[model samples]
Target: MRVLLRAVKQIYRQPLCNAASRKRSIASSSEGSGLLQPRHEKLIFCSTAELFQELGGNVEVRTEFISEEEESAFMKELEQGLRKKRYEFDHWDDAIHGYRETERDRWGAMCTGVLERLRTVAFPKGSTLLGPVHVLDLDKAGYIKPHIDSVKFCGSTIAGLSLLSDSIMRLVKEDDAAQWLDLLLPRRSLYILRDQARYEFTHEILRDEDSVFDGERVPRQRRISVICRNLPS
Candidate 1:
């Protein structure tokens, strides 16, 4: 009960509206109904086509996608759930602690506007958004193995949001021995993978203290990622 009250308090913190408190997975009746929601200040991102060109086709990343206040609310939701339910599956090889499939409507209900915005930016219009969306909770020591996403079950494009901390995602060609690109996935960044990048290259999180980006080693932080996908057409 106290946790929920705390969440309610955070939910009303101003300057950033529509910031739903993610506390112990308890949402207000209005949030549950997706009605009469507060308006959120829209975040504007300047697009540069050449950057995507340099990165590759079907890959887009928007940094600073959410503000600090919103981040706090979202974190409160995840952290409380993590504490109480502790519903996490461990993966030793990948250096991952918790991996689980979650329902989009249940988990996504807290911030409907943000999820809608993600769909508009990440998916083609009129495409059926498929679930079970995944939530990845990682501690400081956590990392993931390099592997290509399966197209058999989950087809085409994959979109995800990085929360809590910065991430360094590495990629390598499946059939090649040479090292590939290392990307700095900043906290609050939204990353999308499709086409060549999805089918061709494999990505992972390494078990290193810091990773290089443009010759500089950048440290990683504990993070929670919300991943959503578009079904194969």
Candidate 2:
């Protein structure tokens, strides 16, 4: 019982609403329905960057991590490298549409150099880079559904370099759907997710019409993300 109470207190520290203290994972009634009651999923869009930091610095972003010149060169290589690969709309679980993904253990000289720089900010000294690096292309109308990175595929840290266009990435707490955050990923920005932010949050790319930040509609277009992960734990 003491252990359970401690767990409840920890959740309480993370704000929900005015009645946050009264919130319980499973609603109960005097009549004792016994069956778990359904709780409405209330998406609270966190417009500020501070909320992300509240997660013990598990999520971070470095804007303009790469310059325009580097971005252009990387984009050119990505397009050229995957020119022949087919973009598949029908994912096995329908998680992504109008997307093409490929992995490469090695990149061209320019890309290799830029990624080396990315490592300094994204990982600790001597952290192993899981290969081949993942390159995903999303069409102008494409979007990725909410899902967690499989522990089987990668370890805790996953860093993505955004290119081509800007978009919103939403992260929802797996245990509490009402708790969520929307991140504006501009072109040339690098976003990193690790530990709790990487495992506990289900990340998704918002559809174009649904992309909004701080009450302003943020337009999304054909975008690509160069994803790098560490070896599985």
Candidate 3:
């Protein structure tokens, strides 16, 4: 009778332990979910034409960009494949060459989508999609110097897709000495530059092994950027 009484007491105590464990598990899961979410505040989504209109309205500050979960996944896959293939740096070779040499055959698809969208917004009368995409690989301390991408040099909008890692692109107006805009281009994000934003402002990637902002220095990772612009005929 004493043994049976002890067993009953133990069984009654088990529920309290299990409830406490469950509460702790729930708290841990919630914390993890919050961290996975993107923390950037200015991330916005807009249709291509809407973005063009906004750009025209605000010449001093104009940027058309978007981030999609599906696109990001595709880009990650592409990055992994490129890493496996060990793509070389060829300054003379165009974007198509890099795409062909890479393991994943995705560069064409990505460029096509951006070109079609840009044409719809920038050239309503229809225009040919010219190519030889520029595939640029930037290492820990590599960066592109600031300069305007004039239509005289390249006749279409500049569409850049981030394949691996994240970086910042700075836009500075020629006239504004103190004003400049910084954009964090995360992995798989797409940035389209055109009009005055392309012709008047200078865009560049800073050379740093890491980036520090708000007192946090984020380490640099290997980055591959696919740049698409129409060739002037």
Candidate 4:
């Protein structure tokens, strides 16, 4: 049981004090040869506040999206429900491993509040939301291969609340992989992908060994993302 709480406990302990200290001005992907030029300078930490502007307003993040109590509660519910589950492989994409997922028609009041807030900020007033929320649990060693969500399943805007661990998500142009940007997704942050970000780019969680940010190594740990999508147009 204690092991289950190990990752969630990081929420109350480690503050993101280093976020500003490691901040850097990244030129637009078009300015330089690539967003991550030189390969050695692959990790760049952009401020979440300016991520919308930095990433052409297609991608946005809201840090501190959930309170500590809410996170703790979510951890408890998920750990118990998913502990006995085994990792499943997708026949379409082999890059994903060590992961389990489930869909929920509805969540508790506590989650409802979070979802409300997400829609309030990430979507326009009275936007239609998909009823089934997707919960994906990825092990510390797990990694998601770069792929775009099929338009048949969901709509344009995709909102995800990241929990448990800090991670780096890379969004690369599907046609040109060299043109890419890295997003530092700290625990409890809400990331919203819409329009170009959702359609033109393939999103993937980097492997543990590749989790670097601004010349520093950022460790990847167990993470669970509560994902919500808008109705298909």
Top-down TM-score ranking:
2, 4, 1, 3
**Would you give me the overall lDDT of model 3?**
0.45
List model 1 lDDT by residue over 72-96, tens digit each: 7667656765655453445433334
In lDDT terms, how accurate is model 1? Answer: 0.54
- Once fitted onto the true fold, the runs of candidate 4 whose alpha carbons sit more than 4 angstroms away are 1-55, 89-92
Candidate 2 has its poorest 10 consecutive residues by lDDT at: 1-10
lDDT of each: 0.54, 0.67, 0.45, 0.66
User: Superposing every Cα of model 1 onto the true structure, what RMSD results?
Assistant: 14.6
Please give the distance, in angstroms, between residue 107's alpha carbon in candidate 2 and its true position after superposition.
2.0
Candidate 3: pairs in clash: 95-133
Off by over 4 Å in 1: 1-55, 85-104, 107-110, 208-210
Question: lDDT per residue, candidate 3, 168-194, as tens digits?
Answer: 665555554233444555566556666
- lDDT ranking from best candidate downward: 2, 4, 1, 3
* Candidate 3 Cα misplacement greater than 4 A, ranges: 1-38, 43-125, 209-218, 231-233
lDDT by residue (tens digit), candidate 2, 136-220? 8988888987777777767778889989887788777777765666666767777888888888777888778887754667788
Best by lDDT: 2
Error of 3 at 87 (Å): 10
